[model samples]
Target: MTPTDTRALVAIDLGAESCRVSLLRWLPTGPQCTLVHRFLNNAVETENGLRWKIDAIEAGLMEGLHRCAAIATEGVRSIAVDGWAVDYARLDDDGKAMEDPYCYRDVRNITSEESVHAIIPAAQMRVLTAIGIMRINTLYQLYADKLAGRPQAPWLNLPEYILERLGGRRVSEYTNATHTQLIDMHTGTWATGIFERLELDPEMAAPLVLPGSIVGKVTGELATLPAFADTQLVAPCCHDTASAIAGIPDAADDWAYISSGTWSLVGTLLQEAINTQPAREENLTNFGGAGGRILFHKNVNGMWLLRGCLDVWRAAGKDWSFDELLPLAEAQHTPHHLLDVDDPDLLLPGDMPNRINRQLLERGFGEISTKPEDAPAMTALILHSLAARYAQVLGAIADITGKKLKKLYIVGGGSRNALLNRLTAQATGLEVVVGASESSTLGNFAVQMAAVESSADAETIAEWAGVLRTAF
Candidate 1:
């Protein structure tokens, strides 16, 4: 596994709205990438609550792997999985998933959020973990399970659980683990003090491993697939944002990144975590980034607003592709109601248009129409609101981290939105550079390659990322 190694690597990026399986096939000329498979991924509403379709996701992944094996006639070197953070799966003693992992958007966390905060206030928790106290964080979900008298067993983030299921060792990757609000930012381990105060068994947490650790070789029935045979299972930035940041092709500290998709993570990378009172009050989170960097950012509600609205529109027989809808939004020049995208009411499922209007009315603003013809206005509103929020968060990060921002890197599916990129640049007054649309997947593959090359150190990861990302 040297730079000259020609073996292919597979990267599975599990996203909130969709999941993708991509392959980097090394060739004599250069590495070539193929999107082996992609499938729509959505949390289904169940009798218990809204939950991820974990079984369906697993099946889809296997199908994708078989396809990759067929294409990569060259032997596959390794594989890795990166995904959204916080929501996790609880496993029993026998390594059985007790139930489907709850979607972070599920309403069940509302009650538990209060109880958990009563024990350890959000501000104080921020001081401990240096992570924003989101209601959907894994800590609140685990607290809910504890209150319901559920058995205490090993609980792993969704990606970690999937890796374990695939014969990789069960361990929490550091980047994703930081999102749980249970890890101490200073020590990079479970906050024993917080867990004790909340009566949680800290042992339930899997051992913390940094990104690029080789979990193990692929195992179980899936290993029988040609692509998985002898394939090492590696952990990239298990949190998609971390992976996306790692996939940045350039190296510089003056630029910020917005891992824009269902959620917009706006921040810059720092070597040290920020836990100042101002940072806590602003709800900024300091996540572990690749290359010994700290992801200092805010989690702003993103495309979920427009995505929910689009669902309502399509159900009403007003169907249009996202491409077609964007131009319509860009063409509409009328001033519209602005929304505080982070409002909790807008965080749930169903009738998003109405919820937005209600918020607008409460704010003494005119209500926008939900009709299909009004899609342009709605889309514009959502995009503008998001850009504004990004700017606000960027300003806060700059103030707190004392980093003078020079450029903004917009990555992920949302990077394709030309209008949003322009608006982001205008709102933040920083040049917005957009590319690496599949950054998380690229980072996933880069990390695997680093592990294979046995140069998985942070500096090597950053260097290898630039070379690997060329496949895109």
Candidate 2:
């Protein structure tokens, strides 16, 4: 078999709503990306709690890899995986997952979060980890496992677990690890003090590695195939949000980004960590970014609000598509009462329309009708509320970081919402630049290309990102 037959790269993006597999091949003219496969993904309520269908996820990804081998006749060069952060799989002694990973949205976190704070105050956790204090963070999730008397074993975040399953080493990528709220922001390692205080085992955590580090090559049955024999597994910014941000080719230093999807992360990149009292009080996070930069952002509720409402409408036989709803929403007048987009009640799944109305009634505002015909009005209210929240978060980021933000680049599936973009631009008074919806896939491939060709340093990744942007 010829080793240099092809320079094709594969990128697997695991998302809350859907999982996608994409391929990037170097052509005579430039790089080209193809969507090999995509499938729906959602958490399910199990006897234990809300859990991911990881076995099904693994099977679907394997199918996509086989398809890639068939089409990229020249042979596959490398592979990478990026996805949503905060969820992880605990492994047994035999190096197999004990069970499907828990979904971060489970209600069990509420008690676990309180228990953790009682041991180590929320203020102290922010000071140590520099991450936003959220009940959904992995720190609380792990403690929840302990509180339930689960057996102790090593755990890997979802993305890293996939890489390990593909013959890579067990290690947590920095970008994703920061989301766990267990890393010391100043030292860039696990906060042993917090673990000791909470009595959680520090040894159970995987060693951390930075993005662009290659864990291993393809092994096992697939390695016998010509296309997979020499494939290297690279851990790109394992957090989908970080990869999406890296995919942006913008050169301006004065601009900020919104990785808008299930969650809208609103913030700018910073050279250093900001763990000041005011910054912590604002509930801003300092997630690790590509090239050792800090993704100083706040998590604002995004399309999840609209998605939840859609679920209720679909169950009632409304089944309205975004294509049909966006125009209708755009035509409607501005909503008189905007939602508190970050309301905790709106974060859970099911009956979103009712939950939204309940908040409105309690706040002395008229509720949006949940009738099928009035769906457009609900859409408008959700969009307007999201835009207003984005503006508020961006303003806080600017004040904390002291950066004059000129452009607001919106990436991910949410970028396709023209009405929301227009509202965001109007509310924030910034030049709204719409970025690629598949930014995570693009960023995944860009980092792989940079790592294989030269170095996956900040400069190299940025250059590759610019080159790939032209393909779209």
Candidate 3:
């Protein structure tokens, strides 16, 4: 396949709150992208703990693929999947999941994080991995499984697991693998020293592959469809944040990005890793980006806070949508008390309103009422807190990277939040450029297009990204 081929392409974005399947078709005029399907995705509490229903997620994706097959008479040429990182599925000997993957938010990771730090201090871990030492990271999650004495088995992160399920070989895309915090910062391979120190089996990890590498041709029932007959499964920045960043058309070095969704990743792209003592001290991460760049950033708590609060309100009969709440939140005066948006207690689910109020009370500020009517106040507080946090992180990024950021590109679901965008611009004092709400989808398709056209090198990705942004 090449640039001249007119076959349509498919990009599957598996998000924390929702999953979408997008289709890209090339026509004489230009490229056209259509959102063929989107479905709600949530972790459910079970006898064990919070776990994703991989079966349901797989079904939803398949349904979308069928829709794409039905609509794209040009025939789908290739497919790729990008998603939130960290959480993974343990696989049995036959490559089948042992059970649903544990949600990164599962409380078990708290103990696991403590245990890992006990053996290999957090500072050392950060210097070794050059990744943010967060409890939700794959290292802690896997350590949790080990502490529970769960059977040892090979594992794959969510997006790559989806690709393997679609008949791709078991391999971790480099961008997603770095999020595990088990990869050597310098070597770009599994950190054997960390594995030895933690007593983990290094072989359990899949071999690392660069983005745009074709894993396999589509197989299984879906492959039987005419549109999928020759579809290749390409790994395109399997970490959704990486793909979202790739979707940006601007090639300027004076811009940072916030892949705003369930979590907001605030950072700028760099030519190399920054694993110095100062970088480790700030808890900033250096994730792998498309074209082998470093995604120097900090993970700030994002929409999850508002979503958790909304969940509590909905159960209490408030059921306010963002559309109904944002205006009210904007109409209200700035919150007198700002939250430490990355508060540990706010990371978990359940009773968000109380958790927020508890933080307020602890800080000696008056608590916001949980009444349905006062939800906007809470919403405003969350947005304000997030914006303030973003500004702080961006400041740190500038100081560490020496990049004078002039623009902040907001992408993902939160890009649609005008209120948050305005607040971020005001707080960060940078010109805010609102990118696509489905930027991950655009990046996914862009990579697929690049892979098929020639190669997914830096120049190729940028060219395709520009083309897609224009068409979008």
Against the true structure, whose lDDT is highest?
3
Any residue pairs clashing in model 3, and if so which?
none
Ranked candidates (lDDT, high to low): 3, 2, 1
Please provide, for model 1 over 121-190, each residue's C-alpha lDDT reduced to its tens digit, 9 standing for 90 to 100: 7777777888888988999999988988987878999888888887889899999999998888998888
Report RMSD for candidate 3: 1.3
Off by over 4 Å in 1: 334-336
**What C-alpha lDDT do the candidate models reach, one value each?**
0.87, 0.90, 0.91
- For candidate 2, lDDT tens digit of each residue in 35-61? 999999999999989999999999999
Query: Model 3: runs farther than 4 Å from truth?
Result: none
TM-score of 1: 0.97
Model 3 lDDT per residue over 1-472, tens place: 2377788989999988899998888777888899999999999999999999999999999999999999997798899999999999999888888999999999999899999999999988987888988999999998998999987799999999999999999999999999999999798989989988988888999999999889998998988899999989999999999999999888789999999998999999999999887788789999998888889999999989999988888888989988999999999999887999899999998999999999999999998988887999999999999999999999988988888999999999889999999999999999999999899988887887788778888768877888888656
lDDT for model 3 comes to 0.91
Local error of candidate 3 at 438, Å?
0.4
